[model samples]
Structures are given as structure tokens and as C-alpha cells.
Target: MELGVFLFRPLIRNRADFKQAEETLKKSEVWIRNIFKSLKEAVFVITPDRIFLDMNEAAQEMFGYTKEELVNRPSAIVHIDHEQYLEFGKKMEEVINKGEITNFQFKMRRKNGEIFPSEHTASLMVDNEGKPIGIVSVVRDLSEQKKIEEEKEKLQAQLQQAHKMEAIATLAGGIAHEFNNALTGVVGNIELLEMRLPDNKIVTEHTEAMKSSSHRMANLTSQLLAYARGGSYQAKTISLSDFVEETLPVIIPNIGPSIRIDTDLPRDIFKVNVDSAQMQMVLSAVVSNSSEALGGDGRIRVITSNEEIDAEFAKSQPGLRPGRYVCLTVEDDGEGMDEETVNKIFDPFYTTKFMGRGLGMAAAYGIIRNHGGWISVDSEQYKGTVVRIYLPAIEAEKKVKKEIITEPKLDIAEGEGTVLIIEDEEMVMNVTRAVLVRLGYHILEAKTGKEAIEIAKTFDGQIDLALLDIKLPDIQGDKVYPLIMKARPNLKVIVCSGYSIDTAQG
Candidate 1:
């Protein structure tokens, strides 16, 4: 009886151990199944022949199919095409040999026939003997990631372009300033020479030629100054639609008779504060660009509309702020530009046309930016190009007064008062002195701000007018103005500079 009891005890202990092992195995299976289903990324289990064995909820949602529908079906149904499936099969052989494949990017198709970019990391599932039995893969959709990367690159490009344009504007402003000073001397000297020279046809012809050449050079400098944002002489709040209507006739002849011009200037369009001349130049540049793009016969549409830029929209466009704006759209149905060409269109000296100076668009860009606006261009090869200029809109109720016009006298008035000329440039000073002396005004000269103040203090004669150059050697002209005013309380003053009034004040 005792021997039988001991044997039974050993049997019972063995049965208990076997039961415990079975329960542990069940727990592990549940754990693994839960992990597979709970994964955020799409997971797939396939047979050696690439038949779908099992899939998680994420996989079903990713492929737009139910688990029961995809099970036992060929995995090729989820691939972009049959050829891509075959290519994937070839890659599976490498996976089998290497024990796994990681980060294999490819295009995938959904049940509704939509193809999107995807990346999958697959591992070889093995049997007890380590023989490849199937594949288990985790997949991630790359469409959003790719989109984010593209946006980042685009923003980087825009930032780079802004920096480049800023540098160019600084250089251009400096050049225009110096060039305008030199031109002042040339133009002033020419005026002096014309007055002094006796009547001779040959001399008159040569001087006129020089004057014409100088004027052309001055025009070129003006364009550079426009590109540098220093060309805005006067700003007025005006209806954009009315301005466009008034200017289109002048632009039409230059566009040529071959091309047709269409305009949709709505009466209720918003008003903007801008220099009329500079705004006209912007329109001309844009229209001329479209005309040149047409190359002979095509339609150019000029349209005006009100736009509201929200914060999200403004975030995508560099240097743009969210606000109400008036949009001027110029669209052309002609030979368009490629992505590369469009990217460089606003760069100074960049052009597609033969012998083109390429300053028009660049100057237009600067003008709009200086007016607290922006320009956007969209183009595709052989399709069409659309340029949108956005200017800040003012309240509709604000009254815009019409500018008064008067005819010019056409003659330089002879001056009788004593003039104080404060200039740093020698050529400018000499020509200016010659002009004032010729005009019958007694002149007092000073090359620096300190010298000008000293002359204002000690000069015995009454200094009636002080022509102050904004840029001076020692102190700024604005600073010197108050000091000289303190010294000569009754003196009148005029501020002169190549920069815009806003810039000079700044």
C-alpha cells in the first residue's frame, strides 16, 4: 500500500507541472497576439508563397480591406502593380538570406485603386529548424512625411531667396545713391555749359547728345533705385481698379497689336497706399513680361480682386503678414516657364529673353515689398503663368483726395537770396555752386555737417536757404538741420537725398 501511494504522488506532481506549462504557453500567445493587434503601424503576416496569412486592424485600414477579405489572398493586391509585386518578391529572397529586410520603400495601392508611397520593414518568420516559413512586415505610410519634407525644403528656399534679395537691395541702393550723385554733377554741369556756350550748331548737337546719353543713364539708375526700394517719391491712397483702367491704354500700345488685352477691374475693389508712378511701373513690368511671353498672339488677362490672408496662409509665404489685401492678377496663356526658370525670375539680371536687362520683375518685387505687399508667381512648362500682386488694403470709408495738377514753368527761376550748400561730394558741390552762382544767388559752401553748422553760426550775411544733403561726412543731415535752424532761426531749409522720403526719415 505504501509503495503504491509514493508512485501516485510522483504522477500527480508530473501532471501539475504539465498543467502549469500549458497555462504559461497560453499567456504568451495572448500577449503576442495583443501586441500584434495593438500596434499603430500596419502589420502583416504572410506565407512563404506571399499569401496573406493574417493582418492587424491597422493593416486592414491601411489597405482599405477587411482581415477576412485579405486572408489567403495574394499580397500582390496591396502592391502598386504586378511588376512592383514581382520586384518585391525578388527582394524577399534577400530577406530570407539575410534574416530580415529593413526600410524598403515602395509605392502601394489601396482597395479603392489609390496609389501612395509607403515604407515597410519585414522580417523572415522561421520554423523550429530555422527554415523560412513566412514573412511578418510592419508598414508606414510615407505620403505625409514626404509632404512635410517638401514643405520644409520649400520654406528653406524661400528664406534663402529673401536673404539674397535683401543683400542685392542693399548693394543696389548703395550703387544708385553714388550713381545719382555723379549724375547730378553731370546734369548740372551740362546745364551750366549750355548757358555759357555761344550758339554753335556743332557744339549744341554734341551737348544735346551728351544730355540724351546722360538721361538714359539716369533712367537706368532710376530702375536700380526702384529695385532698391528707394524710388517711392509720393504715396497716395487710390482705388486700384480706377488706376488700372487709366493706365491700361498707355500699356496697350507697348504690348503690340498682335496680342489681345482683357481686363476685369471691378468697381468695388479695395484701395491701396502706393506711389502712383511706381505702381504704374509694376503694372507695366508685369504686363510687358506677359506680352513677351506671348511672343506674338495670345490673351493676357488683368484682373483685380480683394483677398484676405489668414495666419496659416501667411505662414507659407515668407515676409507676408496676415491682413486684408488687394490682389492684382496678371495671367497669360503663352509659353510658360519651367520650375527652375520661375525660381530665378525675380532675381536681378536674370532673364529668358535676348538682350533683356531682367530688372523689371526684380524692381517690381522690390516695389511691392516696399509697399508692405508681396508677389506670387505660378507657372508650368507649356501651360501658362499667373502672377499675383498683393497690396495692403485700406478702409473703404477713408476718403482719398484727388491730387491737384499744375503745368510746369519750363524755366529755372533765377534766385536772389543767399544759399547755403552743404554737400560732401566735390563734383556735386562744384556743379551746384556753378548753377546757383549763374542763377544770381550768393553761395556759401560746406563739405561737412560741422562746417555747415560753423558757417551758419559765424556767417555775417543772411543765409536765406540751406540745401542740406541727407548724407553727410560727420553728422546726418537731419541732425544738422535742427542745429543750423537754431543758429539761423529765420532760414528756410530743404532736405535732399537719393533715398526715399521714408528711408531718409528713418
Candidate 2:
């Protein structure tokens, strides 16, 4: 009844037929053995009886079991949780019915009872009549792939930090230039008012009132400039509720009239080491940006919470360290951002505006980063955007003044001493001379650096001080300083310019 196969005996034909059948069976065994020898992943099989049937070199290495132990014993030394291994039986049954299967991801146990990620694929073997027999699996291991992905994300965070620093540098220069020029006008008017009228008179009283208004305008402009400057914060302990209440008035006006702002800041005495101005900048930009999104008709909600992040938890967050932080979140119901816009939002000069809406949140990115803080945004198009700012906190202590500082005002001397006021603009130079004359100091004014040297030579008396403009019509600050020093070697020089020291060099 047997055709080409009978376990121990050959086919019933002749002696040559018997020998040929034996040779064919021997060749097949050699082919399977050679294939298993070179495999890198664990390869083996289990019978329906749960006995160790056959295993390749990888399977033997993985299990730490010899061929003798595996050929007859159950594959239990590698898999400690032997009961859970029954799931493989269900997979095998499916493969047997299907004849072939695709690879699947799963966890597997090593010789040391360690479970790791792996994948396996199986095929059903059959007799010539196509009756199902057993399964053959090809296994693969996956630990190195996950490590590469983590490194890539860390590099991206560092790139984002560098971009934030560059944006602050650009914004600060522009703010200082414009705001200080405006302040010069303010202080110039106040100085003029003092000379024209005596104290306590009606004329002097009105002049003083105008001066107060100008100073208020100066203060408001300074606050907005600081928002553009980034990270210049006076950090101290303050009540969270009070901070919000104080910030709301300034921020609300920046938002649109159509937007209804809501707040839920706690009245409890929760204190943190935050720069009030820097925090205000963060709140203003985020809320204003949201209002801009809503087309002037929406609501914004601001909430604060105390959160502690352990080392394990912090590692999961992008660019965050393990510590205590006060989380302030701004939520707005508006037309939110898409994936492309959100990714590039923090980049300098990269804006959603068509031509020039200006640096809307470019400065906001710098302010938070400068505070050693973290900011993240979640947004969906036509839905909303939630911006979260995490700031480090410290314990608040009772305030105390250690000492008092009082610098005495020097009494003005009516001297015949010559003062050379070297400034680029005629308006600024004329104002400087007027202020000095009020103090009874005779003045020699020059509109350019070249003219300044000529005035010093023709001075009627000794040149006392040179109020040199760091920026000049003919020469730069550094160049002018040396020329003036060489000419009037011992002259007392007071460097006065609208630009900050950093900007003067720039």
C-alpha cells in the first residue's frame, strides 16, 4: 500500500528502487541541516505533545540547552513562564490551517529568563496528500532599533534651543534703539520744565504734571520693550493669585474686545521664583496670539497647577529636567495651527503671516528659554491651542532690607570750565547744552566727531568733560574714544548714547 515513503523500509519495487529511495531521503535531511546551521535567530519546533522535536544552532545557544537535553525533553529551561507559552500553540493551529503565515511582533524569553521584543513567522508542513503536520518558525530580535530613535529626538531639542537664543539677540537690539530714543525726548522735556518755572508756582505745577504723564508713557513703553528683549526678569517670591490679578489688566487690553477672557488662578499663597515681567510676557503673547486666531470673537481660559516631576517622569518629557515646577497653561477656543506651522513656530523670522505681521511669538520663545523654563503647545486646526509654560519655583521668605543706599546730589558749580558736547544730532546736542547751562557749566557743542575736535581747540577755558556720542556721523564709538583721549589726554569723558553698551558695539 505504501508509495514512495515508509518510515524504516524502502518502496516495494526492486533492490535498486530501495537504494534510490534511501539516497533521496538522505539528501533531503542534509539540505535541512545545512539551512539551520547558518541561521542567526532562534529556530526550532514543538510537537503537539509539547516535546522538544528539533532546534537549530541559534535555538540551542538561546536556551543554553544541549542537543541531548532538547532532543527529548520539553523546552522549559529557556521559558520560565511555561504556562504562557501555550499562546504559541494557538498561533501554530492558525498557521497549520492557513499553510503559511506572515511575521508577527511579540516578546520572548532568553536563557536567563529575560523577556525581550522579538518577531516570528511560521509555515505548516504537510504530507503529499496535503494533511497538516507541524509548524516551522523563523525568529528575529529588536532592541537596537529603539535606541536610535531616542538619540534622534534629543538632537532635535538642542537645535530648537539654539534658534531661541538667536531670536532674542535680534529683538533686543531693535527695542533698545527705538525705546531709548523716545525716552530721550521724555527726559529732555522734564529738564526744560525745571528751568522755566520756580517750584510751587502755577506754571511750575503744570510743567510737573506734564512731566509725570511723560514718565508714565516711558514706563509703559519700557514694559513692552522688555517683552521683546527676553528673560530680563526680577525674580522674587510672590502670591500666584496676586500675580494673575495684576497681569490680567495689562494682558486684557492687548487682546481684542471681541474675546472674553476667563481666569481660575487660586487665591492660595502659592509662591514661586518667577520674574513677574517675564511671566507677564509669556501670558500676553500666548493670549494675544490666541485672540488673533479667533478673529476677535472667542474665550480664553488660564489655569495654574503645582506639579512635581520625578527623574523617570521628566526623562519622558522633551528637554525637561527632574524637579518642582509651577505649570501655567493658556487655552483658547480659536482657529488653531497645523502640523507644519506648529513645528516651525519657535524658529526666528518663521511666521504664519503672509508678508509682515512682525515677530509675534519669536520673542516669546526666547523669554521662556532664558528663564531656564520649558514651553510646549498642543493645537488642532479649527479647534484650539493650549500653551503650557513650566517655571521653576522656590520657597518664599519674609522680605527684609539689609541696608539703605543714598547717593548725594552734587551741588552745581557755576564754573567758566568748557564742556564739549559731541553728539551726532543737532537736536540732542542743543538739548545737552541747555541742560549743562542750567547747571552753570559753559558748553562747546559739536554735531559731528570732526567738528568736536575743532571746538576743543578753540575752547575759551579748560575742557572739563567730553559728553561723547558713542555713535557719530564721521567715526564709531571705539574709534572716537581713542582720538578724543589722544587730543585731551586728561579730559573727564562721560559716554552718553541711546544704544545700550551691547548695541553700541553691534
Candidate 3:
């Protein structure tokens, strides 16, 4: 059972037989070394006492060690941690005594002290009589395989998140659409009622309250659509100074006095082409976040500035072109966020506030993107947060000035030219017709798009205006619009929808 006897012994009866035995023994030793060296997987032999007995060329390359350096070294040299070395030694003893061990995972350190994942299988090396002598292990590096697995997991998570956001957006859009239609009806009816009770102070006060409530409800619906619609926006040239001024009064009262507000609007007007309504929602969302971060006590500074992004600057933002932009920055002196929190702030349903639907930041992001603009957020744990919105700017000559006009009193009960009202919702149509009727216009009504087209064609084309709803039973109100236009091309048509302009497009 001895190692020397088991490998070198041969039957010999003469001098020639002795010489042949000696040659055969040398050849067998060469063949064994060659077989081990030719293996693709790293192969090494360790003694029962945990010493490195022998290793092949593949093993040398794998561990960045020479055969002379590894031959008598402790088997623990390949493992980084002392605890791991002791653990592997115990496992190796089991492999030497009990047959074999398969697929044992371990972290191995290379010559440069870099650690990588590996899997190894070991079997007992035995003598001619089957007594165990040493352990032979085959090791395979799993670094590349592990990387692939991790990347696949990351991609899977991203796909799942995208699907979830899309589902929520669709739901929000539907709810907003229905709610806006109902609000339109309620508000229209309340106005008509107020007109009838102008002289009655008691009734007028009640109607005023109802009108304010409906207006608030309409604002809520607008925010819902801002979060949901994944399409283009309706952009108009508007003065940024005027917009901020108009929003402050509404913002100041609701945010309370605990939060002090500061503004830095330039004397020279900055004009950006964007949707005013969506931008208002964006500002509301940004300020709401600031107030929440403040927890009812902090300062907010809103500043408007002109920005020119050159090619070098644009390189920082992929897909952005060099251009002039109007920057609206909102800075808050409140509880800020860490890197992890900031990364997920714009993701739908992500929130830190106690009272929130988790859609404020997400809606702000969507609205800005839809307006063909860019938004960036900078924050530190206690230093506070700054959110910057960059919108495309119009030329000086293209700037639009909004003039406030005071309307003189008009007689509310006088007859005028015939007007067409096309709406699918009965309640909405009825309330809208009554309001127009009270405004001294003869009303022509249709509960469906087809009925409206018939009415427009048969009439003498004297219709002053067409109040049309985009959604209809048989056809889209937009499609009906063109057909009605055939009868009266010069008709002043107004299309109404509860949904976003993109979703409502026929």
C-alpha cells in the first residue's frame, strides 16, 4: 500500500527484465504528469496534512503561482480569510477520508490579492490497494457567470417597474377623464343657477361656494391627467414672470405662513413655450414637495434665469441639443434626501410623506418631459433640495403679453343667433345648453355626434358656434367636426374633452 511500491513495482526474473521495468516506470511517471498538465480545468493535489503536493500548468495560471512556489505551500494559501481557510481544510479532510465532494463553492484569492468566486470538486487519490493518500481537486472560476446572472436580475426588475407604472398611468387617465366631464356639468349648472338668483343674496352665496368647490375639483383632475398621459402637451408662449405671479397667491394661502417664500424673477421678461396649466401643476407639485420636506417650517426660494447650453454642456445630458432655455429653480431649506431616495423620487408610487398618493414627483417629471423640457434634482441629507426645470425659450420678438380686460355688463336674457351644442353626456349637454341659452343665444342641441351632423347640415348654416364633445357613441366628435364644417366652413368650433388632448385626439 506504500506510494513507492504501488507505482514502481514490476515482476522481474532477469537483468533484461530489470532494465525494462526501470524504463517502463520512468515512462509511466512522465505520462501521469502530462495527463494532469493537459487538463483545461485547474487541477491540484493536496496531501492529507493540508500541504500542496502537486499542481498542473492550468492550476499555476489560475492562481498566478509557479509549480516550485506551490509544491510544498499550505493549501490555505489560495483562500483569503483565516476562517475560510480553516473551513476548507475541514472539508478537505472529509473528502480525503470519505470518497469525494462535488460542487463546493469558495472564494479564492489570486496572487494580486483579488478575490473571485469559484467551484471545485475533489476526489480521494489512492494507492494500488485503495488506501487514500491525497486529494485531487478540479476548480472552475465563476466570476463571469455570476456577473451575467446579476445583470439579468437587474434587467428583470426594470421591466417589472415599467409595466407597473404604465398600468397606473392608464388607470389615472380614465378616472381623470370621467371626473372632468362630471365637474364640467356641475360647474355649468351652478353658473346658470347663480345667474337666475343674482338679486337673492342667500342663494348667491350658496352657489358661490358650490362654484369654488367645483373649481378645486377641476384642479385635482388636471393633476391626475398630468401624471397619466404619456403623450405630447399643448404648448403656448407665456411669460414666466406672469405665471409665477399668478401662481403665488394660490400657493401662498395653502402652504401656510410657517414656510416663508422668496422670489428672484428678472426684470426683463423670460418667455418659454409650454403648457401653462401643466406648468402650474408642475410648480404646485414642486412646492408641495418642498413644504412636505419642510414639515410646516422652512424657507423656499424660487428663481427664474436664462440658460444657454452649449455643445460641451449638452454632452452631460444625453439626447439634449445645444439651445437657449428658461430655467425655473425651486430651492427648499428643509429635510433633504439621500442618493437612494433621490434615485427613486420620480418613480410612480414612491413617497416619504405621511399623507400622499406618491404621485407628486412622478407627475412633475411627466409634465416636464411632455413639454419637451428637462428636469434635474439635487439634494443632500440635511442641506435641502433644489429642483431645476429647463424649458425651451422663445425669441424676444415672439414673446406674448397677456392683457387683463374688464368686461362691461351684458343683458343675460336677450335672443341672438342660433348656436349648436353637440355632447354625448345628457347631463353635461343639458347644463351647457341652459348656460348658453341664458347668455342670449338660441340653442340647438344633439345628444349624439350623428344627430349633431344632421342638425348642422339641415340648418341654414347660421350657427354661431359649435360646442362639441370629443367622445361620442357612433363616431368621434372630432370626425363629426369636419363633416359639420362642410356645411359651414367659417363655423367657430370649440371641442371639449375630459381626457388629455393627446388621448382625446380622434
- Top candidate on TM-score is 1
Better of 1 and 3 by TM-score: 1
lDDT of 2 by residue, 217-282 (tens): 655444434434421345666766678788889878776798898887876534666567667766
Candidate 3 global lDDT: 0.76
lDDT per residue as tens, model 1, 1-506: 11112112222257778687556556666667787789999998877688888888999999899989998899998888889999888777778888856558899999999998999898887654677777888889999999999999998998888898889998998998899898898889888888888586777888899999999988878888888876545677789999999999988999768999899999998888878998899999999989888987899999999999999889889988888889999999988998888888888889686216668998899888877789999998778799999988876323222221222233337969898999999988899899989989999999999999999999998887787888897999879988998898878776666653221110
Query: Which sequence of candidate numbers ranks them by lDDT, best first?
Result: 1, 3, 2
Residues 190-222, model 3: lDDT tens digits: 887778878999988899899888888876776
**Prediction 2 TM-score vs. true:** 0.50
TM-score of each: 0.87, 0.50, 0.68
Global local distance difference test of model 2: 0.65
What lDDT score is found at residue 120 in candidate 2?
A: 79
Local distance difference test values of all predictions, in order:
0.82, 0.65, 0.76
Query: Candidate 2: deviation at residue 271, Å?
Result: 1.3
lDDT preference between candidates 1 and 3, better one: 1
TM-score, predicted candidate 1 vs. hidden true structure = 0.87
Which runs of model 1 end up more than 4 angstroms from their true locations?
Answer: 1-27, 81-87, 353-355, 396-412, 500-506
Residue pairs in steric clash, candidate 3?
none
